[model samples]
Every structure is written in C-alpha cells, then in structure tokens.
Target: MKKRLSAAISSVGLILGTSLFSPAGAQEIDLYVDTVTKQVYTEPGKNRVKMGTFQQVQKGANRQDKKSSDRQAQKKTDQPAQKDSVQQARKDSSQQAQNEPGPAFVHEPLPERPKEEHWYDRMHIRGYTQFRNSTTVSGDKDAVVYWPDRSVGEDTSFLIRRARLILYGDITDNLYLYFQPDFASTPSGSTTGNFGQLRDAYADISFDDKKEFRVRLGQSKIPFSFENMQSSQNRLALDRADGINTCCRDERDIGAFFYWVPAEIRERFRELVANNLKGSGDYGVFAFGVYNGQGANRVELNNDMHMVARVTYPYQFSNGQIFEAGVEALHGRFVTSNGPVNGITPVMVAPAKGFVDERVAVHAVLYPQPFGLQAEWNWGRGPQLNGVQRLITESPLTGGYVQATYKYDSGPWGILFPFVKWQYYEGGQKFERNAPKNLVNDWELGVEWQVTKAIELTAVYHMMNRTDVLNAPYERFRADAVRFQVQWNY
Candidate 1:
C-alpha cells in the first residue's frame, strides 16, 4: 500500500510540475487520486480514482484568473449593446439641453460716454488795434481826401483806425465760428467818434472730415476782389486800390458762401499767412455767393440780391515761391439814398426803383518770397451823377492798381516790407451820398516794420489827385500826404 501511494504521489507531482512549467498554449492534463490515501495520479486506471480534466495553471499565475477570464468573455459579448446604450444616452442629453431655456441673465460690459468740453476751452480770443495819424503836408488843409481808412485823412489829429476784438472757435469737429467787433469806427455825421461796429459775424460749416468743402453763413467779406478780401491787418499797403475798394464799401455784406479747396492747398494758404507773406487766408479755390447789394451795415433797398462769383488758385514752384491769379464778377441793382451826403448838401435825386450795378474784375498776386507783385483791374457800369443833367444814371467805369513789394527778415530785429503802389480809378463813388462821378490817381511808397509780433509800424508817403466827392461843386483835389500808423496785436 505504501509503494502504491508513493508511486501515485510521484505521478501527481510530475503532472503538477509539467503544468506549472509548460508554455501557455499547452493542453490540459488529466489526473486521479486514491480515495483512502488521498494520493493523486495523472492516469485514472491505476488507483481506480477519477478526477476531471482541469485548467493548466501557468507559471506564476493565480487561481482567480479563470474567474477573471469568464468576466472578460461576458464583457466582450455585451460590447455592441453597451455601445448603443451610450450613444442613445448622449443623443438624449443633447435633445434635453435644446428643449430647456438658457440662464435668465448674462453679464456684459457697458459702453463708455464721451467727455464734454468746457466753454472756456472751446473759444479763443484774439485781436489788433491800429493807431494812426495823417496830414496833407503839401496840399489844402481843408481838402477832404477820402481814405480807405476813413478815420485819418486831412486832420493832423491822432486817431484810432481800428480797435478790433475777434472771438473764434471750433464748436465741434465740423462747425467753426468767428466774431469780430471794431470799437474805433466813426459813424458818418456823428459828433462823437469811436463807436463800436460789427466787423464779422460768421460761421463755417465743413462738409467733409478733411474740410475740403465748406459753407460760410452770415456777415462776411464778399468774394468780389482779391484785394477786397484781403484783411486790412495783413495788408502791406495802407489802403486798398480804390478801383476794387469802391466795389464793396466795407468789404463785407450779409451772405452765404460756398468754398471748395483741396486739403493740401489749404495748408499752403495758411503757411503763407503764418510766414507773413500777406496771404488772403483760405478763400477757397472756387467761391460763389449772394449778398445784400447795399454794402455792409446798410439796409437792403431792393428785393434783388447781388450775385458774386470768384475762381482763384495758388501755384507753388519748385523753389517754394507762390503765385496766384483770379477773376471775380458781380451783378446787382442798387438804390442810392437821397439822404443828406455826410450831413452835407443833398445831391440829385436817385432812381426810385434802382440802377444797374455790375462789374467784372481780374487779379494776380506773386507772394513776396523776397519780392512780390500784385495787380487788379475791373470794368463795369454803375450809378453815377451826370453833372450837366444832375441825374444819377448808369455810366461805364474802369480802374485798377499795381503794387510791388520786397520782404526782408532781419532776424532779431523783426521783419520789414517796403512797397510801392500806383492806382487809378475813373468811376462813381457809389457809397458816397451823391453817388458822385470821381477820378482817383494816386502813388504811394511805404515801409512796414514788424518790430515784434505784438507791435508794428508803417510809414507811407502819398501823392494823390482825387475828386472831392463830399463838396457840392465836385472838384479834383491834389495833395502830397504822409501817414504813420502803429499797430498792436494780441
């Protein structure tokens, strides 16, 4: 019995050892055990004990691996159904999300507001005053020689030609305003002089961001003549040409004007003024407007408005010299007032309806980049007194002036401009009380010294032969006069 049991145990040990050491692909092994001795064997026939075939345990593997394998196999069989279930769950979740409403409120940033500008910062103040004195050094002391600056002519009395205050500002990006008042104006026939008068009250509205197109409204300078449009403060000549000056009494009238200029050209115009080249400001490359026919500060007598138009351009050379040329024309009906002439004798009665007032002028300017020349001429028919008939009738008139000047920069000593001008006009003095027929032949030589930015001095000698339109028997008066003016700018 011991030999048999030993043999069975040895056989079982051999089978177990083979199963543990064999490769994973090896076949299962069969075994038997003796019931009484509990001895195992690989063959069933020897001990008459039977054991079923079993899984081969690989080397270093645990007994629980079979249970794990059974679970893995069951998971593989159920994979398709599980995958479908997961897909259906995702689809259901997406549909539920779409059916539900979103959150009640969402947070967002607010837009910022623009800062407002202060009134004081939106406006600017600037002005100039001219103190002047003039005497007829070699002519009749009582002879009245009408001057462009009517304040100083024959009297040696010291006077103020202009005491102006200007307020200008850009109210917004597209709107600009300009206002000026002259405190030194002397009203005709008034005993007291130096009364304040409106000079300019206008607004410029830009139509584009570049400000190339604009419209000016209210009382402003008429675009009738180049010299007429030039500001007296910037002019080198003490007086404007009588030919052009006669066309517009105060060089201004209530009107609306349109101006168009390229942005680049506008800068050049500003540079000319900033450099003291006597620029006319930005009058535009082309300008047209309608204004009251009765001149500045005067009531319109007729329903018809004065139509005026002008075209001008400044050309710059490679050497930085600028030249300009332009033409302007105006047509209107003017009613001469039968009122007392400067508180003097009333002349012939004017037409009840009005007289045809029309003119066409041409002007040229060479900005003094050292040396300059300016000239203007006009021809037209206007109301003038027929001395023999003593009636105000339309008469042909023509006149103009030519001026030459030189600009000198003296560094710290400031600057100087010496000019010579000769002017002739055979026309009607429409602004005068009688609308008298007048002839003006004048020669002037002057030097303007800009001692400083705030101070300026001008001295001019004039030889004038002009008709005395004030007195009843209008006679031509000749005089040699000298005038001096000092200007203060701020």
Candidate 2:
C-alpha cells in the first residue's frame, strides 16, 4: 500500500514538470497596465527581454500610452475649433458683401501728362484807335494848307485817324510772323472808295543760333529811317517827320530785308522797343532791303526796284538815357502816273515816263527821359514840276525836322510831355497827282498827356508856310492849325 501511494506522487510530479517545461510554456509574456485606470493588458508579438520587473515595465508602457492618448484627444478638440473659425470667417465676408452697394464703374488711375497747345495758342493780338479834331487857325478854309497827306482835309472836323489791329506770333522756334490792318483810311485821289487796308504781312526767318541775324520777307516796313520803323503807337509826334515820309510814303512796302544786330546790344534794342521809346527793335545796327518803289498800296508801274539801306548805333548812359545816330540811303525810279499822257505839257511827258530818284539822310535822337532832342535831314533828286520849265523835271530836294521835348512823370497822374518841332521840306511828291512841287516850312508845338496805360491825349498848335500844291505853281500860302487827338489801345 505504501509503495503504490509513493508511485502516485511521483507520477503527479513528472506530469507537472513536463507541462511547465514544454516549448509553448517556455514563450515569454509581456503585460501592460493602464496606470490611471489600474487595468492590465497583454502585448502580443513582442519578445520579452527582462530589463526590470514585469510591474515596472508594464507601468512605463502604460504611462507612455496614456500621454499619447491625451495628445490625440487635444488634437481632435483643436481641429473642430479651427473648422468653426473658418466657417465664421466665411459668414462675415458674405455679410459685408451684402451690406455695400455695387460700384457703377471700375476705378482706373489716369496717366499724368502735359496738355498740348495748338499753333494759334501762341498768337498775340492787340489794336489801337485814334480820334482827331483839327481846325485851320490862320489860313482860308479853301486854301491849300501846309498839312500834307491825310492830315489835309476840311478845317474843323472830327475824324477817325486810325483804327488798326495787329496779330503776331511765332510759328516755330526760329520763325515768326506778323500781320496788321487799318480800317480807317482817307479816300484816294483817284476814287472815292475808302476801305480797309493791309499794312503789314511778313515773316522773319532767323539764321543765327542767337537770332542776331534774320531775313524778313513780304510786306514790311522799309529799313530807311528810325522814325519810320518806330510803331505809330510809340511815336511822340502826331505824325512822322516829313523828310523820311517823303522817301517811302506810308513807310511800308513788299520787300525782302536783311537785319543784323550784335548779340551784345540785342537786349538793349529789345528794351528800347518794349519801352516804345523812339527806337526800332533790333531791326539791326545795319539793315538793307529792296522793294517796289511806287509806295504802299500802289502796284509797281515800272520794272525798277527800290533799294534802301540804313546804319545806326546807339549809346546808353549810366543814367538810363539813350542817344542814337543813324544814316540812310535810298535809290529808285519813280513814275508819276499810269494815266494816258495827253502829250500837251511837261507834266504829261514826265507821267508817260520814269525818272531816277535818290535820297540820303542822317538822323540823331536823344530819347526823352526828362529832356530830349531829335533831328533828321535829307537831300535827294526826284521828279518835280519845274515852274520855270513848265514841265516835269528832275530837281534837287532837301528836307528835315528837328524836335525837342521835356517829359514829366507824375506817378499816378501818368506822363506829361511838351514838345516843339520845326520842319522844312522842298521837294516834289510824285505820288501826288501832277507831281506837285512842295515847299514847306512849319513849326509845331505839342503837349502829350498819358492819363493811363491805355489812353493818351495830345494837343498841337501849328504854324506853316507852303507853296505849289493842287495845280498851283509858285503860289505861296501860310497856314496854322490846332489839332487835338485822343488815342486808345486794347
């Protein structure tokens, strides 16, 4: 009985040892636990190398898993919050679009640029008008007086002496043009027709870089005399000197002229012109031209062309005073009339032909600051009615005018100038009908007062002696007149 019992115990021991040592039973187990929840879990497919006790390894794994799960939960919570923010932004943008009104047009920025100017934009326009009243104070009403040209008329009357408009501008940097017309003119001796007349239509071509040299083309003032070149608006005397006037009647002709001034004196010349102080602009220190010799408004009757030249020099004092001297010469052929010659008299013989005409003149001027002096003298040979020959013949001629003036500037009252002029002329006026001989000695006293920049008043008293006018040969006459004039500029 004892042996059997021992055998049973041995058998039991063997069976338990075999099961524990088998290959499946030898595989290691890795256990993991959640530390916070205190739960156990098995990690499959992992080899267990004993680093510490099972509880320590399991506790480390459970702590790492718990941190990872916490991180994931936080990420999940943040995603929904970010999505809500995006949806809210979309909603706000939609609300703003609905609140604003739609624009009518899209805004576009304009390119900045300069305005272009047309050619006419550079044009300058100006004009003047004159009203005059004259009366004969010493001569009979029907008697021919010393007054010549348009100044000769009925004794006591008011007349429009001049109404003129001027247009001028530059077409390019080097080209300039000027135009002027007169509306009020006296009736021609040949016809009662009095109409608007063109005075100047010309262009200036500059050659030098500084424009010190130029050529003037078309109808322009002949460069024969300083006074003739001086604009009517600037003249101190009511009329131009007879000496110069006789050479080139009306002073303008269709011509080509060369003008030149030294660059140094050009500014001074411009200042004189701008001041309207009895000086032509830098027309030149030297000038020359060729023109139709028959005078302004008359067609050329002969093929011969008139040639004119002038040389002038100006000196300025430190006290703003100017003195100028000039010499002039003109040569031309003159035809008295285009009418059919009757062949009865010398007058008819001369009118049927052309004659040599020549003139030389010298002039000096002292621009009136407070005191001034101006004088011109001329001598020439021209066609004249010789009373002795009872026919037209070439004869010696001489003429000139001397003037002195005193100017006072009263500030706001404007300028006042008192002047005296003496003129003597002995010549023949071929332009006048019948080639009338003219013998004139005249004295004029005048006062000019400038009320404003645009207005001026002048009064003149004249004493004269004249001969051989209006078909009367050797008939001497003395006449005097008082003239009043008002001028306005615009």
User: What's the true lDDT of residue 39 in model 1?
Assistant: 52
The TM-score values for the models, in the order shown, are 0.74, 0.76
Model 1, 1-490: lDDT tens digits are 6655455555555555545433344446665554544555444542236787644564344644655566466655544544453344334433433443344443455888788777558999999999988877787557765646564465448888889999999888899999999998877667677899998999999999999999999999999888888888999888788888888878999999999999999998899889899999999999988988898888888788999999999999999999999999999888875444435444544455588899999999999989999999999998887765246678989999999999999999999999999999998888876688889999999999999999999999988889887655677878787889999999
Q: Give every collision pair in model 2.
A: none
lDDT of 2 at 233: 79
Candidate 2 ranges with C-alpha deviation above 4 Å: 1-103, 112-114, 144-156, 190-194, 338-345, 348-353, 468-474
The alpha-carbon lDDT assigned to residue 155 of candidate 2 equals: 40
| Cα-lDDT of candidate 2 | 0.72
lDDT at 191, model 2: 35
Highest lDDT: give the candidate number: 1
lDDT of each: 0.80, 0.72
